[model samples]
Target: MSVVTLIGAGQMASALTFPLFENGHEVRLVGSPLDDAVIDRLREDNYHVNLRRTLHDGINYIKCADVKEAIKGADLIVCGISSFGVEWFADEILPILDESIPLISVTKGMLDYEDGTMQTYPEYWQEKLPEGSKLRLYAIGGPCTARDLSDHDPSFVAYCGPDFETLEWIRSLFSTDYYIISLTKDVVGLECAVALKNGYALGTALAIGIKEKLGDDGIDHNNMKSALFQESVKEMLELLRIVGGGVDNIMFAAGDLDVTVSAGRSRTVGLLLGKGYTIEETLEQLQGQTLEAVVIATRTARAVKALAKAGKVSIDDFPLLMHVDGLLNEHATLNIPWKKFERHM
Candidate 1:
């Protein structure tokens, strides 16, 4: 069994750790110093994951006051922190990580302030690790949710890495009856697909809500919704293509369309926004964590513009780019003519 060290004791971390423990792998879990209450709870519970139906136990717990002590002898390090916290963790924790240890990043989303760069969790850490370190980086993405896995339901996720051996190793570590893990070699494309799917989901939710509000007193609402979804998918695929992603990434992102467009935390946030809720108001009402898609939409709008100017893609093929640009610029009342968009096609 591989010795695994997981950083961040959030929902994702909890879901991943339980499987590792059940597989007989020695697991060490580290939580942020600021999360004293959660640390206390984990200590009291003996690092058992109380999944409501099943209790998973025997994982070692460390209340990380220092980084070196947390990852001294770890073979594989899994990071489940939020995207915004990546840089901070890199600076504070990754420097102490073992040089030969392989790393897995489950976090998804683009860095909005960083020129709209879409980086997976491992990529962020690789940038911070020692220059000559032989650290291998891997990424995990797909439609799987923490709640589904915790409930012992089957869910699929795609894992990709530059190293085939490391990819296979991670796949072996996480695979279970409830969690299906697949390996891939398209690391860049995989990460980009994961980030762009969120923007498409938001767009899909908004279009659905708008269609419902338009009072379908005789309109082909179903066709409109279908067209909107297809167009959004195409737009995302095109955006990814312009940024050098592969067709397989597009296929994987589309295959996982069920969760993105269906009812979920991110889609619900989009629905609320469609109903005219301000960002802050929507966040408050949901009482849930915000997905990085909101910022992604804005950055994607900028990226589309750059691509169009560079002739990487035709503006005529994606009129949504123009609409998104206007939307991001706060000109919310503007609309693109269907004929103009169709002409480009």
Candidate 2:
């Protein structure tokens, strides 16, 4: 059995300990500086504070102060923090990291540069490592959620890396009967696909909010939702093309979109926007919760705007995404822009 040291006790990270521990790995879950409360909860009882679920027993819980010692002799390292923890992980973990140990991130999002360029988390992390470091970077993307994985639901996802052979090795460690794993060498495509799902999922979910605003709990606006879903896949494919990723990567993109449109913080924010809440009001409603969809939507809109200026992509090509971004950042009201979608068709 391998010793798998995870660096964050986040929902997805903590849920992951179940499969790994069940698979006979020695899983050490180290809490980030932000996860002290959750770590204490896990220590008190296996109950996870944020996830609202009990985790598997026999997993070791290490505090933030002991992260160094917790990672000792780790056969594999899981970068389980969210995007907000990227810099912190670099500053606190990278310096002491063993370059030979491979790392896989469940973190989803891309970093936007001053020039409006975007790079996936793994790419950004790779650049921050010491020159000539042997650390291999990998990320998982798909529809796996914290609650579902915690219950050992049959969730399918892709473990994406630069090398196919190594990804198979990673698959061997985490794949279970309930948690099926697929491998992809298209890192950019896989990362972009999953990150794009967050924004598009929010966009697709606006119909629910719209239906609620229409004062009809009995009627489902699945028609509008399905249209948004299709347009999302189309735009996602174009985004991948511009970024030099395989268009076929839409498999993960569409599947993630399907799952995300109905659940998570993305849907929550989208519902708020559809109910006519201002971004400030919506954010207040989500106080203390992370909105990955809003973060990626606004950042991707800015990046794509730069691309549109460069004639790499048309700003008009992403109506749902741009509309969602406006609702989040521009003080714009909730308008579906069905006209823009028609033009796209």
Candidate 3:
């Protein structure tokens, strides 16, 4: 059994920990003081997950104060931290990690400050690692939610990277009665798809919320909203293309099918925002924390506009690009006419 060290005790981390423990792997969970409180609650309550109504049946708790101590002898290191925490983690923890251990990131969303300059998660981590350190990095993406996994719902997740053997090993480790793990070499595509989907989800949510506000109005707002969502999905895919990601990434991001525009937690957050609730207000109302998509949609919209201005992409191909830009910039009055957007039908 591999000794796995999971850094971050968030919902996602907690959801996955049960599977690792059940599979007989030794799990060492390292967390901040706040995260430690979450762990304490889990242990005191006999390990309850909101996602799953079932209770865990094993010794799943192994808390560590420092990341170095948590991962010192670990065979694999899983990072489920939020995107915002990644840089701090790389600075404070990655340097202490042994080069031999493989690192798997379950986080999604790009570093806005990095722009498209940093293409993939592995590349970002590699830049932080010491030169000549042979560290294998892999990314897990697809539509598997923490809620589904916590409740032992049958789910599939893709593990992809340049290291084929390592990817296969990870696939094997995660494959269980309820969890199916697929391996791939399209690491960049996979990561890009994961990041871009957040923006699409948010944009779709906003469109839906707007449609609700325009009830019985002259515009066939529901139909227009649906088209807007579809167009946004296509636009996001195009943006990913400019960044060198594959069409397969879209399939993975959409959960191997055409996902409804109003799907996922991030989209729900967007809907709330569209209903005149500020970001902070939406967060307070959400049953759980919102993903980076709410902010990412805005950042990516700016970056895409910059790239478009630079002649790096075709503006005509991404009509909704400007609309997303308008939404993100809080530009209530857009230069583009509303009737022109409706004409796309």
Residue 264 in candidate 1 has what lDDT? 65
Which ten residues in a row are the worst by lDDT in model 1? 46-55
Better candidate number, 2 or 3, judged by lDDT: 2
Q: What is the lDDT of residue 267 in candidate 1?
A: 73
Q: Evaluate model 3: give its lDDT.
A: 0.68
Q: Write the per-residue lDDT of candidate 3 for residues 104-177, one digit (tens) a residue.
A: 98877665443434256566888788879898888888777777787788877788877789888877667789
**Model 1 ranges off by over 4 Å:** 46-55, 112-121, 211-221, 284-288, 309-311, 321-331, 334-345
Among these predicted structures, which one has the highest TM-score?
A: 2
For each candidate, C-alpha RMSD in Å?
A: 3.4, 1.4, 3.6
lDDT of 1 by residue, 95-136 (tens): 777767888888776653233344555665777778788877
Candidate 2 residue-wise lDDT, 227-312, digit = tens: 88888888898888877789878999999998887689999898888889998998999999989999999889999988888776
Error of 1 at 167 (Å): 1.1
Of the two candidates 1 and 2, the one with more favorable lDDT, higher being better, is 2
Ranking of all candidate structures by their lDDT, best first: 2, 1, 3
Best-fitting candidate, scored by lDDT: 2
The CA lDDT of each predicted structure is 0.69, 0.88, 0.68
